[model samples]
Target: MEPVLLALKFLVPLAYLATTAIYGRLFFAPEESRFARKATLGLAISLILHIALLLCLGYSLQRCPLGTIGEGLLFLAWILAVIHLLSEWLADTRRLGLFTLLPTTLCVVVGVFLLRPDFALPPQLQSSFLVFHIVASLASYACFSMASILAGLYLVLHAKLKHKNFDITFRKLPPLDKLDKLSANWSFLGSATMVVASVIGWVWVRKDGLAGMNFKELAIYLVLAVFLGAGISRRLFGWRGRRHAIAILIGFLLMLLTNMIGTHGFQN
Candidate 1:
């Protein structure tokens, strides 16, 4: 098992790289429809290997794999890969693969290389409910990242159109409406997942009779508020077009800030 885990530590990143390359080729050469199937196969294979690697690492450590920043990043990479693959299967569009998988590959490479398994898992963090809460939070973050990426692309394409710059890059991107819809879908998913995470945290707090909130908890709640606002504005006020897209981008930024504060705290 040790040897297998060691091998997987390296194989997972390579698999992500190979999968990303497949997506790149598919995106640049849309004429060759053959690459579509190949891309999907590569993504699926990479995702499977990534999952196996994480599971093995967790088993060996006798703890969740998210004990450190690197491990948390690996988990995010896994979730991003999972979401992108599901999007491809459900939407039947490979247009977003290159954009999505490039960051995923980078995350895997950084995470795999930066892994610090020697770090001890805190005893207080071993509760199953806490693990679920953290998992849910990470899942929400991954979805928010996806939503932001989509929104950024939409903005870029929108700018190109406004400037009358119709290049191959513009043509390669999904249509504005498609990008808008995809971004909205991912944002909604992120919001819903964040709600779940918040609920889990609340339940854990009540179950343990915790008295006070930590900085990380405050940040999470603030991030949740941002997403909830975005959802409400879109639903009730009929906010659409660039306004909604920009709102999503802003929410993503807030999420990132929350992560940073959670990681570093405000002791200074």
Candidate 2:
């Protein structure tokens, strides 16, 4: 059973990748069609496979999978996939599936590279706070990163419109106004979630009697500062354009660094 589940862990990602590619082509080919529908279905299948893998892991050895870097990545990927689908279900989301599912595919590929071809839960990584923290924070990061990239692309297009340069990619993207609103909304949600995740992790650490400020903690603080500061600038001073995009990208990268430090320094 574990073997079969492990095989599924491999097969599921491959299927999602194929779906993403096929649907991406159909999406951008002649006319914008039901790419979202196809990606959503693919994402749904991947979630089920992740659940099956979790069940197999629990059956063999009850573990939380929080202690390993490899498990952490795929778990984060699954969480982001869920967030992506839910966000679409709740609101108007278009053409972001490519970004979301591509990263997910890359994450699973990393998992495959680190695969041991078996399931055994880690003994030292059992914390509900950590689980929720990773899930919420990574999902937040996923959405923010997706939105930030789109914003940057929009800025590129805007620049082209100003008689600077013209390109094919910029010609096909959504309108600048649409990108602006979506980026603002996504950033707002992600910033809130990240703040919550950071607070939760701090509470858990303090409760566990391990209240030392680590690199990851510092990184989180810095990211929060940048994101919130940019938000303030956007509101108060009417800051926009490249500054907004840069701040978003900077915060996104710092969030990635924070996760890396968290996984490497504490878990590893």
Candidate 3:
């Protein structure tokens, strides 16, 4: 079991790197080129392997493998890959793969190398509500990450359009309007999921009689507040285009900081 787990730990990242390479080639090649098909196939295979790895880890540990930060990172990467693939298929855009896979690859690398392996499940996490809360939170994070990538791309393309700089890359990217809409959709989904997760977390806290807010809890609430403000600003102030995109980027950064503080701040 240990040998198989080790092998999967190595194979998963290699598969992602290969997918990244394929997508990189697709970025340079035409949209209808064979590389696009290969990139999709590569991503499918990588996602399958990643899911299998998670399943095997859960089987070996005799519980959900998301008990540790390392395992959570692995799950986070898996969710990101799944979301990216679905968005690409729905939008029929291959160019975004380059932007999306970069961060997924980074997550896998960090999970495998930087995080310590821990399989011991905490007592509080054994509950179904708690498990779903964490899953929803992580899934929401994945959506926000994707939205951030789309927002970043939107800013780049918007700037290119403003400067009348029409390069091959610019031509390959989705239209600014499409990018903006996609980013907004992702942000909406993320915020909705976060709200549901927050409700579940509150219920769990009340049931368990946990103490006052911890650093992680405070950070999460702050992220939720940011999302709420962004939503309100967009609807009431008519903040669209670059303004909306910048809001998404800021929200994603805050989410990242929340994750960092959650993972490291409470360790001591």
Candidate 4:
């Protein structure tokens, strides 16, 4: 098991790195989409290896692999990878791979460096409820991260069109409307997932007789508030395009800050 885990730790990141390279090639020279199928296969295999690695790590620790900040990074990479693959298939767009997979690959590589497979969970955090909360929270974070990437692309493409600079990159990008729609869809999903995760966390706290949330936990609520506010502005004020995209970007930053704080607390 140790040998398998060690091999997987190295292989998982390498697979993601290789797949990201393939996607980078496809992004620049989309005419070479003959390689897209092969890239997708590689990404699928990477995702499988990622899951297996998580399982092995969890089994080795005798707890959920989600007990530390580094483990959260691993989980987030897997969630984002899954989201990217599904979005590509559903939206039928392959050009966004470079933007998405670069960060996903980074997460896996950084996670490998930081992962402590021997870390033990405190008895207080050993509940089934905590597992669900962590899963949903990570899912929400991934969705927000994806939405931010799409929003950034939308702004870039919008600028290129405004300046009348229709380069090969512009031609390769998904249409403005598609980017807008995908960003909105991901933001909505992130908001919904955050709501569910928050409710579960609240219930768990109450069940455990905790009086209130800590500063790190409140940071999560800040994230939820940002997304909720963005959603409300969109529905009520008909916000879209640059305005909504900017809002999503802000939420993404907040999510990152929140994760860092949480991770710091865990390490302490």
Cα RMSD to the true fold for all candidates: 2.6, 3.2, 2.3, 2.1
Which 10-residue window of candidate 3 scores lowest in summed lDDT? 259-268
Off by over 4 Å in 2: 34-37, 115-124, 163-168, 261-268
The pairs that clash in candidate 3 are none
Residue-level lDDT tens digits of model 1 in 34-136: 7888888888888889989999989888888987888988999999989888888887657679899998999898898888877886555556886787799
Please list the residue runs of candidate 1 whose C-alpha ends up more than 4 Å from where it truly belongs after superposition. 209-211, 264-268
lDDT of 3 by residue, 17-135 (tens): 99998888888776548787889999999998898888888878877777777777888999999998898889876778978898898888778774344556556566777578779
lDDT by candidate, in order shown: 0.83, 0.69, 0.83, 0.87
Model 1 has an lDDT value of 0.83
C-alpha lDDT of residue 170 in model 2: 55
Candidate 1 has what TM-score? 0.91
TM-score of each: 0.91, 0.83, 0.93, 0.95
Residues 73-169, candidate 2, lDDT per residue (tens digit)?
6776776677667756764544556666777778777865665535553433356676778766776777677667657766777788887555654
Off by over 4 Å in 4: 263-268
Greater-lDDT candidate between 2 and 4: 4
**Which residue pairs of candidate 2 clash?**
none
Could you tell which candidate, 1 or 4, scores higher by lDDT?
A: 4
Output the number of the lDDT-best candidate: 4
> What lDDT does model 3 reach?
0.83
lDDT of 4 by residue, 48-106 (tens): 99999999998888888887777888999999999999998999767788899999999
